[model samples]
Target chain A: MLYFILRRILMLVPVVIGLTVIMFAIARILPGDPVALAAGPNATPAEIEALSHEFGLDQPIWTQYFHYVGGLLHGDLGTSLLTRRPVAADIAAYLPATLELVCAAMLIAVAIGIPLGLATAVWRNRWPDYLSQVVAIGAISMPRFFLGLLLQLCFAMWLMWLPLGGRLPIIVIPPPTVTGFLTIDTLLAGDLHAFTMALRHLAMPAIAMSLSPLATIMRMMRASTIEVMGQDYVMTARALGLPRGKIILKYVARNAVSATLTVIGLYFGWLLGGTVLVETVFDWPGLGLYATKAIVSQDMMPVIGVALVIGLLFVLANLVIDLLYGVINPKVRYS
Target chain B: MTGPLLSIRDLHLTMTSFDGAAHVLNGIDLTVQRGEIWGLVGESGCGKSLTGLSISRLVPTPPATYRKGEIRFEGRDILKLPLREMQDLRGKRIGMIFQDPTTNLNPAYRVGEQLIDVALAAASHDPSVLGCPPGAGRRERRRAARRLAGEMLERVGIPDAGARLDNYPHEFSGGMRQRVLIAMALIGRPDLLIADEPTTALDVSVQAQILKLLKGTVADHDIGVILITHNLGVVAETCSHVAVMYAGNIVESGPVSNVIESPAHPYTRALMAAIPTKASKRGTLKGLGGTVPNLITPPPGCRFAPRCPLAIPACTAALPGAVDLGADHRAACIRLEALEHV
Candidate 1:
């Protein structure tokens, strides 16, 4: 096990580097000029040239890439053109909100999806199963932006229940120091008003973000549950006069969950990709919307930065999943 | 001839699909006496496992429908019992050991946990296990669960059952897993244990060990065992009674010694001839020379008539009924008179 853990950790370096390289290349190849964007459209050519020289954009792409990669080895992520701040600073600023939202959404999804999936499998060809199928299908078919808008319309505008978007109300912007995330910082101060504001604002966006992945996970879990039910152990469990609930829990779900993990990993990576739409629709400022802003403004550094961050996340998420195989199922090892 | 602990009478199972209705098990009647091992020997698709599953009320309803039958255990019709009652009877009164040791035990669970699950499921009804009325205390239940796991593991010859109970299924070898399964089934001390091709998944060496374990386990207890296998040698070694099924019908059945020494049905003879024993020497050996008739539009008469060398005119296009050969031995064949006359 120690051997496996050490080997897995070692192997992660090249994979992370590969993802960073691909993301960096893709961001660079895409048509854009960061220096011109920074200098502004009305700026004189001399000013744009000066800005380009300042940011080292005058160097050849290869030289720039080598410099960027070399800087990355020493923990540099360049600077955001808009903020005139380090790109890593912007990520440090934004990451926690994404983490909280994504984590909360995944928790909501799996907590609901797994049991509902199992329930659907249990009541297969019945009303409950059909109902789950309908709900999942609806979630899958509908656009995330549409769902986000609908949620905002219903919950925020019509009912005036939830805050439509943003981390907190502007009136009580908690000082972000230890935790860069406004929501966490607000709660750390034991500020109930601020926490409630953060939570209310989080509702619509998180649910909107969660729906499609929830549907995907539900479908996978249901299929896997059905497949596991057909296995010999389930029959053995049944033949023992094992209770329906016990059999489902021990024999069916136990085996199915392992297969479901791969699906969950794939969906998780997809969720990172899908979150961009949710963030844009809800006007929730996170890595997704952050990337879009960078793209539109032609801020190539932040674009590369956002792409690298997300690409790293995708790589790490998959690595975390692969590592989980050993924990969930002892039969498999990294080796 | 003590009365059977379980009796499967006139068992008929049919599977209806888009193609047609396939009659899988046709009138499979057999008796399993207490403490006796009956080998249901036939190649794949013979419905031996189906017959075993029927006893526990585990057969799938729609596709694998019981066209007609009575599976009696402890003088009660299993098919007639409520699902709740049947669930109570399973694992406790009747347990099943399935084929494929790899898939038979859940991979995600620890051996001890699964054993305890079976034990507690069986013991939940017993006042002795709970040490009180229903809804036992948490601490007591936990203690009982552990003790039950230990006792079961000890019974199955797993060393350090207490410490090793937390170990997952893959940690154990194939033979060990089979032993664990046997322990799980026997934890309830069931009256009838159905072993469906128990040794088929194990290697040659492990097969012997498992068979030996099963024989010893059965001998120690008075439980009846139904050993389902296609291997004649295994049947000869372990079972007291042997029932030969062909295309879902039991064509021949009698005392194991009697069946092996002298098989009544031609299919049984063909199967016997097919297996290369010490008698059938040289590279050239006899074979039945035909596959089983398609169950969907199964031949109007004997399913094995097309393959039987001694098949008479009466054997074709005509259903054969039971021919009593005395001493509880029975065979479904038309040429019984010819054999008796000889």
Candidate 2:
């Protein structure tokens, strides 16, 4: 097991290198000059030339790539032209917000999706199954941004049950940062009021972000549950006279959930991308919002930094999933 | 306690699907006593496996329904038992092993974990026999069950049983997996066992070994077994009694020796003739002609009538009653007397 985990981590080296290459290439390929964008339009040609040389933009592409790689090794992500701060520092500030939102959305998706999937499978062709089918279809078919808008319209505007947008109400004093997650920070501070307010603000955006992944998880879980329930081992479990509930929980669900776990892990990586739209719509101060602002002002460093961070996060999520597989299935442990 | 381990009388099962209701088991009768291994021999789709599933009430409902039958296990009508009691009876009183060793044991769990689960379940049902104390704590009960599982695996001829307990089902070979399955089934100390083509997925050499293991286990446990198989040779070698099924009905059944030496029903005779022997030449092996009759809208009277060369008009008029042939042997055929001369 140790060997397996070590090997999986080692395999990430090439993947991280490839991600760096892509991030660098994407930043370089975009139209417009970073130096020109950084220097105001009123700046003279000589000033632009000095800024370009200072930024090392006058060097050949390969030289610039090598310089970037060297700086990356030293934890320098260059400076965001718009923010005038280190890109890594900018990412560090914004990332936790995105992480908090994504984690909450995932928690909501898994908490609801798995049970609904199992229920649908067990009560197949029944009302519960039919209801989930409608839910799954609606969740999968509707666009995330559209869903976000609809949720905001219903809960924030019409019902006034939730805050319209943003991570917290402007009137409330923000909790001191601990984990950079407002809910946890508030709880750590023993401020129940702040936590409650944060949760209320989190509800709509989280629900909107969760819907599609929840549908994917539910469909995968339902299909996997149905397939596993029909396995010969399940029949053997039935023949063993194991309690109906135990059979479903221990034998059927244990086997069925592996497939769903894979889908969840893959979706976790994709959900980071999903956050851009959701974060933009909700006006949440996160990496997605940062990336959106960077793109609008043509600030390439933060864009590259965000892409690298997301790529690294995607790899890390799958690694956790791979490790979890060994725990859930013995076959994977030996392999 | 005094009668046979299991008795099925006038058992009839029908499967209702979009097509129609198919009569899967037609007025079947079987009796299994302690220590008697009865082989139920038949071709595919002949209701042999279904009969075994019926005894355990493992057949899925909706698609399958018992039209009329009484399955008495230990003098109690299992058919009338409440769902909870029926669950207790299964795995504890009656254990079942199925075909396809590759799929029977869950791939995700260790072989021992699966075995321990059954042992725990059985102990819960009958605490006295499994040596688990009435008020044993969770850990103590688990340790006891694990020990029992290890012992059962060893009993089924798995070498290094203690170490092998941690190995998953996929790690074991086909025959080893089947042996593991047998261990799991017998872990409960069940009074009866239903082995539905338990060795069918194994190699020819592995098949004999599995059969031997099964026979030895049955003898040691003194448990009745219903060995469902398509191979007549296996039945002759391992079983004390044999029942030959065609379509949904048992055409002939008796003492294994009596049935093998002098099969009375034409279907049984045809099955025997199909077996390749030292005397039978190459290409001379007589395969039974015609497909098994569809159970849905099955031909009236004798199900094998269409395939029987000596079939008469009387055979199609009504289902023949079992005619006694002495020595506890019987065959369901009207021309028993005429066939006696042949």
Candidate 3:
């Protein structure tokens, strides 16, 4: 397993390097100048040139790429043109909110999706199976932004059951950041009231973001489960008179869930970066919303930084999933 | 002195498919005595394996339905038993080993873990069936179960039984895997064991070893066995009694010697003729023409009438009843008198 993980990590170096080159080239080809946008339209030509030189945009593209790569090696992600703050520090502040939301949403997805999938597989072609299929399809096809608003309107405005989206209540003082995750930090600070408020605020957006991925997970799980139910080992398990629960959990689930795990990891990494529309609808302050703002203002550094972070996250997630194969399946040996 | 361990009376099974209903098992009667091995011989798709599966109710339903019959184990009606009791009966009172050893064991689990799972199931069954006290402590029970699994592997001739506990199913060779399967089936000390083509997926040398192991185990443990296979050679070597099946019906059955030497049914005679003996090795061995009839629309009367060389006009009218040939020998055929006289 150590060898597998090491090889995976070693393979990632070239990939990350390749991604950096693409991000750099893509950012440059976009029809906007961050230096010009920062200098303002009314600024003198000399002042514009000065700002460009300061930002290293005046240098050749390759020279700029080398300079940026050198800073990146030391963990500096350059400065945001809009905020003028270090991009890495900015990402750190915004990432935790997105992390919390995506984690909660993924939790919701796995918790509901797996059982739904199992039931559908067992009761295949029955009314319940058809009903669940319709629900899964609806969830997958429904637009995330529209779903977000609909949830907000129902739960907050009409039912008055949950809070409108935000990280926490403005009137309440947030707990000091230890992990930067609001829910965990609040609990760590012994602020139960704040934690409860955080959960209520998180409810709407999390549900909105979870639906599509939940459908995807359920579909994958259902397919894998149905495929496994026909396997000879399951027949052997049944022939052995293994209790239904053990047969489903041990023999069937272990084999069936491996395929679902890969999808879950992929969706989780995607959720980290792809919650742009969901974040905007809920007015939730996270990396998605931050990236949106950065792109609009032509802040190339932060946008590039977000892409690099998200790409790295995707690769790491897939690596972790590959490692999980050895854990779930005894046949999968690291060597 | 004692009644047969298992008796099937006029067992009929039909399978419903998209095309039509298939009469897969046609009024079959079979009895297996304790401390005896019964071989069910037939070509592929003859429903021999299905019959074995039906005994334990392991055949998949939705497609399969029992038309009429009573399966009696120890004089209690198995068909009448509730599903939960039936589940308890499987692997505790009755165990089954399937044809393909490559697929029968769960690939993701270590052989020992699967064995322990069976041991655990056996341990939880009624104490009388288990033949021991339920034992004390969960930890002690688990350890005991593990030890028993190791012992069973050793019994089946797997080398380094204790050390091989952690090996996955894929690690074992085909023959070794079959041994693991045999070990699993017999580990519960089941009253009856059903082995479906247990040696078909193995090489010739391994096939002999498995047959020997099965013969020894049945004899030593006094457990009844229903060994389903297509090989007449295997049946003749290991079985005490043989039932020759054709198109879902047992055409002829008796003591192995009687069935082999004085086979009453034409299908049985044809099957024997197809085998390559030392005398017939250089010559063109006789082959049975025509395929096993499609069960969905099987010809009326004896399923084998179309393929039977000795088939008479009356054979096509209705299925024949089992004719008494004496000494526990019987054959289902319309021309029993004519054939006997000849």
Segments of candidate 1 deviating more than 4 angstroms:
A1-33, A175-178, A181-183, A333-335, B1-3, B127-136, B279-281, B316-318, B340-342
Candidate DockQ values, in order, are 0.79, 0.77, 0.65
Give the whole-model CA lDDT for all candidates, comma-separated: 0.81, 0.89, 0.88
Better of 1 and 2 by lDDT: 2
RMSD of each: 2.7, 2.3, 2.1
Task: List the candidate 3 regions with Cα displacement exceeding 4 Å.
Answer: B128-135, B281-285, B336-342
Question: Against the hidden reference, what TM-scores do the models get?
Answer: 0.93, 0.94, 0.96
Alpha-carbon error at B83 in model 3, in Å? 0.7
Error of 2 at A188 (Å): 3.6
lDDT per residue for candidate 1 within A1-335, as digits (tens), equals: 66855675677578657756776676577787767777778999999898788888788877877888887787788877777888888877776777777876887788888878887888899988888899999998999889899998999899999887887777886655566555677778878788788878888888987887788778888999999899888888888878888888767886677777886777676777667788887777788888788778877677777666776677667777877876777788555
Candidate 3, residues B86-109, lDDT tens digits: the string is 888888889999999999898888
Model 3: which residue pairs collide?
Answer: none
Top lDDT model: 2
TM-score of chain A, predicted model 3, versus the true chain A, to 2 decimals: 0.96
Q: Report model 3's TM-score to 2 decimal places.
A: 0.96
Q: Please give the range of 10 consecutive residues that has the lowest summed lDDT in model 3 chain B.
A: B126-135
In candidate 3, what are the lDDT values of residues A1-335, reduced to their tens digit?
67777887788678768877987887788897777888788988899899888888888888978888899999999998778899999999998888889989999999999878887887899999898899999999999999999998999999999987789878999999998888899999999999999988888999999999999999998999999999887887787778888888788887888879989999989888888999998989999999999998888889888888888888888887877877887677688
